[model samples]
Each structure stands twice: as structure tokens, then as C-alpha cells.
Target: MDAGAPSEGWPLDDRGVAYGDGLFETVLVRDGAPRLWEYHLARLARGCRVLGIPMPAEHELERPLAQAGEGVMVLKLIVTRGSGGRGYAPPAAPAPRLRWQLSPLVPDAARWKVGVRVRHCRLRLGLQPALAGLKHLNRLENVLARGEWSEADIAEGLLCDGEERLVEATCMNLFWQRGGRLETPRLDRCGVAGTLRAVLLERLPIAEVDAAPGVLAVAEAVWLGNSVQGLWPVARLDGAGGEALQRWTIGAVHRRLQAVAHEPLGYPTRLDD
Candidate 1:
């Protein structure tokens, strides 16, 4: 919250941060632009309609994002109810607050070096059919998942449902190479339907399977995919802490990512044209 920032735009409402009655999209900005604008905007429009918020013009957000800095940037778009009175009741014809922030996307050292160290988080993802796959603002579940282990060595944590079914990684979707086929968990009942995950489903030969906790043990390779993280390898995945950057190499995984780094959605600049 900078001093120059308007207080009204930030909007405080019981339905917003309190109830997560809002939607957001963290657009992957690459080479000074955001990738997958169409998909993000479509999801935003649908979320706003469901939450009863008016939709903002897409180009208003995209124009600024297209003119961002180079190398990896992240454009986070948040829309919420503009300052509501204390009550569960909706604000009649509430003005929607549109907030956009630009931040540098961490270049994912996990993918470049060896692989990210991951562990099973204690937090369990509860199923909510209505808000199951929506990228809403209520992220206490992900917050708790990442907070499960605070060690600097830990890159990410795997979250599972109460039934031990794999939901997703703390902030990304999970994909594994099993039996010469790519399998990802069906996020119908839980987890965020990530933009990258949606693109992968369209572009790659993948199948939605019942990816539970057991899938990790038998799968030949495990990777966490996200708009920001890209595709990170799971080098060391266990409860107990292990060695840093072991002999195991994820070069094959890295090469695969390199092959498709700018292929998904045909780069971010396409949206600008």
C-alpha cells in the first residue's frame, strides 16, 4: 500500500478478503508481456458473474500488462467488491474494485538447477463444488499448506484431500509421468484450475486420473506446473529432511521444459497484437 495508492481502489469489504468473494489471476509475464490473457479474462468474467460483480474491460488490464518490463514479470489482477458495509448481505449494484500489480517472477531456480524439495503438507483440501476450481481470493488452505514446513530448503508442499486424494501442490498443479502417459488429477471437486494446467490439457496428450498420494510413489517422474513456476522437478520428496542437490539429475525434465518454454499459448506477445 503505497502513499500514492488510492484507498478506495484497494476496497475493504466483509465479502472480499473475509469471505473470498472475489477472483484473481496471476498472469505469467514473459519478455515484457502476459501469457494467456484470453483464458484469464474468460475465467475472470465468469467468476465476477457468479459473485455478482460487474466485469471490467479486458483491454484496460491487458494494455498495461503488455507494456511491462522484460525477462520474467508477473501481473496479478484482483477484482473485489468496492468497500461494503459490515454484513453478509451483498451490496446492491456494488462497484467492482479492479487492482493490478506488477512484480518480478522468480526465475524458478528449482527447474534450472536440480529439482525442488517437496514434502507432504498436513493441511487437507476440503471439497467445495461451487468454489472448487475457481481461483478465488480465499487462500487460507494454500497459506496453511506452505506454512506446514518453513525450512528454506523446502520449495513446495503437496496437498491432499481428507481422503488422501491428491488435490495439487500448494500453489500449482501436479503432473506425473506414469506408465508412459501423462496423468494429472481431476480438479472437479477441489484445487485451483490453473491457466497453465488448462493449456497443458489442451496442448499435451494428458489424461485426468485419480491422482492420489499413492500416485507419487509409483510414478516414474513428478513435476509441479504453474504459470509462474513453469515446470519444476521433484528431486527429493520425503517427510524427513534429506541432502541438498543429491546425485539424482532432473536434466531430462529441464530439457523438456526448454522445448516448450515459449510454445504454450504461443507466447505472451500474441495477445498484444
Candidate 2:
């Protein structure tokens, strides 16, 4: 891949664009360096395993990654099982396709300062245990949910499973704080198991719990997290027609999580820097 041209574009018969049959990772780059690189690769590898797509070696991507991530940006890596036959059956010995790009990242400083307002999405994520947590290309549910709201103030939309259990936000993982502890939705059934969520689970007092329909109403604080944006404190959550349903204050725990997010990821420079 060329530095100027990240992709040759996908073939018309590519499985990824065809049936949403691939996985992707969005990594953060800061000052010409990639952040949390190993974790990103691990997540992409896991996604490949679950999808039956062969994982490419890290060295195969180093050049292009270094080229694209020449500055602060979002580097997206996609692995498809290549172009395949028509219908559901893939090629027996399918060639895997790798594509990547780096796009300029615009920080949401206002939300980071005053906190973000989220609304409940009308669209519910369907349960697919096999695909859950993979960050795969099948994201029509997210697209619909994201399109549900157009207000400038509503930073994100929360989604639930078919059973009305909280899954996650349109683009990030959900975390609720109570009694100085953090609890997040279990993604075994659905939702992406975010890379930042993984780091928090390993380093913080966070638990995986089932988020019932009204769980957020009683929580003291709520936050949305992903690798790129770090953590976004949720000041309010609302339902359709902009009806106020739950409100949370940006409390000590929120600040603590922000600190944890900024903590060095064993890198010379801070990951959040």
C-alpha cells in the first residue's frame, strides 16, 4: 500500500462489503506514533479468530501504519476474507484482504469538559453471540441508531439488546458508576468489547454486569469509553422526544477514571497525550 493511497478499493465481490464479513480496529495515533499498538493488534487478532479470517502478521502492516500515522489521527485497519463467491459460502482457501487509513481526529473538547448528553436509541441490537465483541464490519444497527438523533447537543445514542438490556452506545462501551465502583454491560451476548474497556477491566475496579432496562436511572454516574476518545462523562440520558429519564453528576469516580485513562500505557509518552 502507498502512503498517499491507503486502499486500492475493495472488489465488487469482496465479502466484507458484500455480507459485512470482516473485522476492523480503530487505533489512535499521537504525534506520529501509534498508541496502545499491541492491544489493538490483539483485538484485531481475536476478531479474525472469531470470524474465521486469517490474521496478518504485525510486520506486514508496520510500513503502511507508519506512513499513515504520521500525525495525530485515527488509524483504521480492516481485514476481510477477501473477495469470494456469491451466496453465503466463502472460498475454501480465501485470500485475506487488508486495508488501512489514517483520518484526522477532531477532539470533542466541549464534551470532555462539560460532559455529554446521550439519548436512548429506538433501534435495538439483535443478539449474535458469535459476532458480539468482535468490532466486525456488520454495523447497520449502529448506523441506524446514530441516525436516530441529529441534535448537536446529543453526543451519542445508547442502544439496548432485543430484550431491552443495555448493550452500549452507538460507537462506544457503556459504564455506570455507583458507590465508587464501575460497572459495564456484559458483551457476551452483544456489543463491542472496547479496547479501553478491556484496559479498565484489567486495571480498575470495574465489573461486567447485566444492565437492565432502567439500570442507568439509579446509577450515580455514567460514562462512555473507547480507545480514541478515552472516557466521556455522561451528564444526562434521555429517551425519545427528548424526555429526560436519568441524570448523573460528573463525580469523583468520573475524574478518577479520566486519570486512569491518562496513565501511561508503558509507553514513553502518555497514551492520552
Identify the leading candidate in terms of lDDT.
2
Q: Write the per-residue lDDT of candidate 2 for residues 160-211, one digit (tens) a residue.
A: 9999899999999998876766899999999998888888888987889887
Worst lDDT 10-window in candidate 2: 264-273
Worst 10 residues of 1 by lDDT: 1-10
In model 2, the Cα lDDT at residue 227 comes to 85
Clashes of each: 0, 0
Model 1: residues with Cα > 4 Å off, grouped in runs: 1-9, 240-254, 265-273
Best by TM-score: 2
Error of 1 at 176 (Å): 0.3
Candidate-wise lDDT, in order? 0.71, 0.80
Model 2 pairs in collision: none
Q: Where does candidate 2 stray beyond 4 Å? A: 1-7, 264-273
